[model samples]
Target: MARTYSLNTEAAKEANNGGKRINETGKYSGKIIAAFYEKNQKGTESVNIMFVSESGQECGPLNLYTHNSSGEELAGYKMLNALMACAKVQGLTWQDTPIDLYDYDEQKVVTKTKECAVELQGKRIGLVLQQEEYQKNNGDIGQRMVIAAPFEADTELMAVEILSRISQPQALGNYMAFIAKNPVRRLKNSQASQPAPRQAENPDPYDDDIPF
Candidate 1:
């Protein structure tokens, strides 16, 4: 017996693949859409931020070693200071108050005060995108983009006026063509990337330990 099925070509051609697209390495102004903390082997905290470029393309899973949960004075202290300073550029403010009763006068009644942490989402920032290349254990060349934390005087800052300029959508047409050509692969990839009910691990994990 032969089984027949109907094919809806137009519908099938709109599927999405599981491969997360990375932005081309370059300086750009972007908005942080998501952020979270991931711990390393030594229990150090790294801030992971997902950015969407002005072009409206998702570009990052940018990792910055900005804090130490252990608080033992690790290497990232200076970087953390810079990050805190940069918070001001994003319209964030810091509030400080004396911790001792002796230091506080009648005007200040509280013993302690605290500033809000950087709220990255919906904030725009300028970044220097750098590309690093390494040979994998399998002898494949692996390339990745990273934020070149700019602290030097020579670091170029994108002008404030231009930061608000609109960017054309970068991938819409090509993406449509990609789905048209690889519809079945896209469908399979998407399905495989979703987590199953009892599975704890990611179904389609990338090779690198660091989330791009």
Candidate 2:
């Protein structure tokens, strides 16, 4: 059976993510379930991505795009590039293709389409999840685990400590070793600064009360 893909153009579910927050902040091995490019009416371009562990769980349909610029590239593109680099080092190749985006709201078969690095679908990669705060409708600080970094999936996922510098993932080409120097701060979401040892081998394994 083919996996169903939703563009999720609606404002993300904000109330405990509509009670679907089953993951926590930590590292997880997964694949790029989907990637797409979109330009809004404001003429802002974005690359949206989704991730999941084939064995269990899912995250995102998160937009990796931002107006935060650094030199010739946007920070979001660098994150996407790092994901691509991770997969490429694992022998995944790429090509341009179209993605069928479904509109599940109106009982529709298909309501939208877009071209992207379609070849990236299902490519293995690693994600470093970090919790961030968002204001709830009740003015409470809600937490969500976000993809903070992408590393090569083929490496020992347990030993993945140092996420590469935005300028370095393509060069280091592996998860075990890093660029070994100061990180170039290109984006607010990711800076090559290493993470502390994971409290669990796998972060949230889906409890009924998962924060994110």
Candidate 3:
């Protein structure tokens, strides 16, 4: 399939790689628009999920790696269950996906399947959030609003003790304190301060005067 450019649209355009929404610490609600099974180099299997809120705030491409390479049974499995329960996401439909292929003729990489890995898109999710601030590669601080809390799309239940154990909201007192003590490191830029070498000039590359 070809691509279409939405040059003149009032849509929520995605921020280029390191972009984030400036939000506050509170309850957030959204739906899971993307989810698919993924595996790591160590053979750990996971489902990567991403969310978008009503006001266009995004949370993740967060990974829930339950199938561990180290084979620790029941570790991190409960979190995955919470997501399914809240979203009412039942009946997983997994398929044989092709992850290693390139189409040179189309000049693109393609995976042909019904939603490819597993169709878990458009499922609702809720979170208790905090706009955790951190510095960036270029010495500028940027806000990253990570979504997905596994709470119902209506409540964070932040105060209840039992709620904390079950729901797993982002910024409970314990987690927030830990974060304050050890702030998240800035995003690493692979091409950090790399030289941008200019291409060799064609002398008059933009000269439109064709003589012939």
Candidate 4:
């Protein structure tokens, strides 16, 4: 029998859960639409990078907490490596010196920070989403930070273009709001398709993104 293969748009839609275009494990192929620095009440600083699906759904404000108040690395190196990979894919230059997370906080530092800002804004990437149970701002068990990874060869290319060019801000906001309202349930692996058990209490952020 001859082999037949085709993109299943309907299945894809179902897997995406009417949100940003994503794969079964919730892998997103989109560009970084927004990036900003956020400081928690405890004075811990982190950068928030948001990726919008090609369909204009906001998939994440992926947090990269570079340092604590004591100046310690907290998942900053991983994020830097991902950024370097993204730069390599786009043919951008990067320095071999130590990465300064504070540089990312500013709009200057042209060669390093500025370039990263420009490249990440509207540039395509492959974001990996890992679901975890957390307490929402409203005291609901529906909050989780959808993590992301850098672009890779096997990354699914959905919404091949950027979302800003195709969607209005209001529409994008509505999509994000919808996502915020709906709790992200854990997805089973492709092979099993069995449901995973939910935890009764909040825990640390799930570290399940594919190693880069």
List the candidates' TM-scores in order: 0.42, 0.51, 0.48, 0.46
User: Candidate 1 lDDT, tens digit per residue, 70-95?
Assistant: 66554344333343323323333333
Ranking by TM-score: 2, 3, 4, 1
- 1-212 per-residue lDDT for model 3 (tens digits): 89987673334344432234425455557776566677679888777666667667666555567777776743335556555645544446776554422366787756533233354577667754544345767987776543223456654433222222345543344544543443332244532222222212122211243111
CA-lDDT, candidates in order: 0.42, 0.52, 0.50, 0.46
lDDT tens digits, residues 81-187, model 4?
45434433322332232222324457543332312344455566666565545555686555365553344323332121111122222322333344444435433
**How accurate locally is residue 138 in candidate 2, as Cα lDDT from 0 to 100?**
100
Which parts of model 3 are misplaced by more than 4 Å?
1-26, 95-119, 129-148, 155-212
The best-first sequence of candidates by lDDT reads: 2, 3, 4, 1
lDDT (10s digit) by residue, model 2, range 69-101: 332445565566555545653222345555444
- TM-score, structure 4 vs. true: 0.46
RMSD of each: 19.2, 14.1, 19.9, 16.8
The CA lDDT at 86 in model 2 is: 54
lDDT leader: 2
Better model by lDDT: candidate 2 vs candidate 3: 2
Residue range with the least summed lDDT across 10 consecutive positions in model 1:
196-205
Q: Which regions of candidate 1 deviate over 4 angstroms?
A: 1-22, 67-84, 87-118, 135-139, 150-212
The reply for model 4, stretches above 4 Å from the true place, is 1-25, 89-116, 137-140, 153-212
